[model samples]
Target: MSSSTPNKVPSSPPASPFKLALCQTPVTLDKEENIAVARDYLMRAAAAGASLAVLPECFNCPYDTACFREYAEELPAVGFKPTEDHSSPSLKMLRQTAQETKMFIVGGSVPEIANDGNIYNSSLSVSPDGTVVAKHRKAHLFDIDVPGGIRFKESDVLSPGGSATAFFAPEIDCTVGVGICYDVRFPELAMLQARELGAKVLVFPGAFNMTTGPAHWELLLRGRALDNQVFVAACSPSRSEGGDGYTAWGHSMVVDPWGTVLASADEKPALVVTTIDLGRLDTVRKSIPTSQQRREDIYRLQSVP
Candidate 1:
């Protein structure tokens, strides 16, 4: 007999109709406290019967350039185990919690120190069995100057990631695409993930400021969902008096393929839970078949990788 274990068996994903949990918690400066709070929120989500859980970006450190270096830690190479030499309390917690809860976790984003010695804003997708399934570095850095409103440049310290992250989560029975904050602004990433990578749902662990949050947050989420004909979810840290005057918009939401807002939350630390129906996604696609109507003669989206 073959030596593959039960967990390694290649069986079809369990029948769908799963629940998703969005943890819109607060980000604190203390690394240990931040990790503890995240762990608690994840456990709470698991208790609520959610198979998939998402966290907000910068959930461990302040959203500031000066703090990235201090908070940055080496990460496990893609699917490998964490290195004992480096400090990775956040990653360890994610793995432990996923194993304990038997839930797939999209670990928002964290500051990472790569071998190149450059710090990157990165997100990890962990399987229910605590395996590091995928890693997504923020491809497009947030570099903007809104005149009198806000002037924050991520290019000042953080380096941009060069690849797209789309992976299948057998536990959740769906393919998920990950993007951090400003990566949502560029439609190419979303389209590529959903259209090319066969991602049924796209999750953006973003933190939009007051200026952009109220204006374009919902609009962008809805637009991406409608155009891609896929479920979309955005998780953000709650509004708080953060240091350096950085205020998050704090409205975490989940949208259906039909561009309908299924669930959303106000500017507070809350666990937003919603049930995502894969059956309805199929119904929506059948009702409006846009994928087959694309004109390859006129235009086409190619995947370099």
Candidate 2:
């Protein structure tokens, strides 16, 4: 069996559709440099007519398991509040860029310091008006010893999110499901957003290593989209050499409801843009009706043996 379980599919129809942009870029040690790169890519996405742009996980810092302390920042206040002056400079730049672009931006996953001084890997969605629409803590920590000998104990420095987050995007005309890096490995979280929250577009900000990305990245993404009949998009941080002492397999992609890889970025700094047709989602759902064709009677609730 795979290390993680698959997400569940929703038993309903999509309310709407939207254009998406996937920003795939390399992270740099210099905070300002990284922001500049992200801003540039985001502009390209906006120019390409994407209503929303999603960034990669830890786009602001190295994805090293050990650098969480040096890079972590306190969650900004409710509004356009900036991270403290001494806080991560990347946070300030992201907030400012979102306001300027007038486009909804999902600031992939970042290291956030909670009020209680505990650190959590978190993601935030920013509206064009600069309001923080949704804040999602990563539910499934990337804690595993990969078969190739790579080990990631994300739980050591971060706390898991207690609930799923689904938010409305006026531009998309539908709700969105939020996820980060390793969270995509758990399909239950995706199902919670698609089935319970009625999200049509599932967004994930991820950084997978070459060890696993080549093996499971695309498989997992296509599986989720096929099962849920909803669009799946992921922004991935580009590989780097400095702090992480690790390399990321940056195959950022956008998959359609029919499990098609509509667009993808292959091992480079690039912008992936794709148009989502909501009507097609409904068409597929009607044909398959997997959500409604349930064997609920057979899979009845039962206690663990």
Candidate 3:
């Protein structure tokens, strides 16, 4: 909601506009082909003049719990770049694509093998120079049972992350918060990113199943955008071929500060490109001023020790 923005100290205001691309490509069992497909789409997005490009959750692997560990990849050490000798194939591709395209990339969510021998659903924001600017392991592991509708437990194989994640994206001149699918359900994380970290744009790479997608996906995104007074973009993979026990709701979209859908894609493999300006967010915040009216004396929402 207000400070130094997502990763770096401010040099100027994000009062200008920039183009964003959301790649809603289809996920397949073959990891090599998936990476290749994402690479091709990302290059096209850059050619289309997007300063930033995003991919869907689990773009490199299947979404099922049983398949997590099988496709898990060890991440690079902090402050280091991924390489053929040190990084997973997926990360290597991401780094290469970011460098090749000269565009900031939100690599969506992937299964990561941590040092503790646990797997986590993680998202990474890579700069145009191929540096990993931000990394967010999902803080909220979705464990929902909708009786006859759906029952999936991410906690079955994934460990929850411990902190909020945001970074100052020099490419877009704003602090951008990165969150995976289930993390979008919790407003606390978004509030932390927007208020505490000064994130102006929040990106969520989600894969909502048909059972929940049509009912709440867009509504949740719109709510987050409206309440936080920030731009929000969510990317979802296309509906699976055989569904592989889970079929995604393929509607990747972007919402404005006023809860308006700027650009969106239906249930098919597609690319969505739209322009975003932090100037609009500033206008909304100036008119509403909810960030200044919070009664912090009564209660405060903050990170717990």
Candidate 4:
């Protein structure tokens, strides 16, 4: 395999010991109510000294594929003329909440209406000053069917994002990569962010269901962290039994560079907090030197520009 770096690699990783809050909130039918609860959790996280707060996938709406189109709202285009009316209720609330809390907010995956009129499962990262720093549409759409288990085809209604996303988090003095739901299944995305973009953390806002959650949730989190020697965090919606739509597997967690579970939440509405130490990242990289010792002459991974 050949690997390519479409963007310039960072010279070094960012500073460490940043506090992160994973808000595993309940997702109700009422979008407004859900946003309200998310806002409350963000405030609580900030008050508790977290500089970064992450929400679960589809936090403002039901995770049913059928509901994506209904909940889809226009997102402000990057560098577009006269800023469009930030009329999308979800976007408005997220922006305002980030500003009010004075914390970086990873507004989790929302059904977004793109300029091309397509819907995408997208995540947005907002700065403490309420500016959108980065946006990542789920690159790997969740499309799976397990016999007598579960079936979900996000591709039926949503389009996959074209590029990997990583942006600097001034609050934490580090770079973070944003991914949604199924995007966590692809290790290349994490590798690109950690190895190429110098991202110290990868935040995935996913809603894995009963079938895959119990089987691979923790395993995947730890695997990614160990492989990249970076912090990996997954924020999931709280489980809801007997719900009409998808039943989320809620065990939101954060893993360290050494593949240790720093903090994890049970299958309930919770605000899981953890401190990510950049020093550990440096220690791991120095001890193993896996990233620098790669056999590029034998095999390589190519990045898509």
Better of 2 and 3 by lDDT: 3
Stretches off by above 4 angstroms in model 2 are 1-17, 77-91, 241-244, 300-305
Q: What tens digits encode model 4's per-residue C-alpha lDDT throughout 206-268? A: 999899999999999999999999999999999999867899999999999999999999998
Lowest lDDT 10-residue stretch of candidate 1? 1-10
TM-score, prediction 1: 0.93
Better of 1 and 2 by lDDT: 1
Prediction 4 global C-alpha lDDT: 0.84
TM of each candidate vs. truth: 0.93, 0.87, 0.95, 0.93
The C-alpha stretches of model 4 lying farther than 4 A from their native spots are: 1-16, 78-85
lDDT of 1 by residue, 177-200 (tens): 888999998888888887767678
**Highest lDDT, which number?**
3
Could you arrange the candidates by lDDT from highest to lowest? 3, 1, 4, 2
lDDT of 2 by residue, 197-304 (tens): 778889999998878899899999999898789999988987665443768889899998999999998888888898888777788899899889868787632212
Question: Using TM-score as the measure, which candidate wins?
Answer: 3
Pick by TM-score: 1 or 3, better one: 3
Model 1 alpha-carbon drift over 4 Å, by segment: 1-14, 82-86
Better of 1 and 4 by lDDT: 1
lDDT of 3 by residue, 178-238 (tens): 8899889999989998888888889999999988999999999999999899999999999
lDDT of 4 at 236: 98
